[model samples]
Target: MQFCDDCGSLMHADGDEMVCSSCGARVPKDRERAAQFVSTEKQTFDDVIESSEEAADEGLPSTEATCEECGHDRAWYTIKQTASADEPPTRFFKCQECGHRWRGYN
Candidate 1:
């Protein structure tokens, strides 16, 4: 990850040199420094465990919001900033009885 010395643009690796994408400037890559970035081992995510359906909803807080689909008065809720930072965050609700999901804007 090298930048152009003249125009401060991001540079990409060419055959033996780093070329600037924006300004077209080229710089010779140091062989010793470039070799340090090379990897020999293959990466794997075999140890990762996916969350179960019950475990996914365990941490959510519950509220008295009504479910439009099943008329349930209780629901599990989570707040997220779906809009811009200047606007209020949205409230997402999942019905405890029917597993129906809905969103409410603040």
Candidate 2:
């Protein structure tokens, strides 16, 4: 979780030091700080499934947009702020039948 002070890039825990991936900066890690950054937990499939469920479209609203790939007349959509704050948000559509994805700007 440490970042390079010079380049602001993520730093990897090397032997007795934190090495920046972007810049060649190195920072010495103390014994207490080094132990805090070490990870002993193992990742499981259940952890991935739980995290991916938040991005799923199961709870998203559906509309009557036509899918170009399958010609399906229904789709699930989500709106996101992709542009600057002064600009309008973007609408992303996913085809209900074929799982095709597209984006529309407002």
Off by over 4 Å in 2: 38-45, 50-59, 63-73, 80-92, 99-106
6-68, model 1: which lDDT tens digit per residue? 999988787888899998999999788787664324567677555676667757799998899
Each prediction's whole-model lDDT (CA): 0.85, 0.84
In TM-score terms, which candidate is top?
Answer: 1
- Candidate 2 lowest-lDDT run of ten: 46-55
TM-score of structure candidate 2:
0.49
The superposed Cα distance between candidate 1 and the true structure at residue 73, in angstroms, equals: 0.6
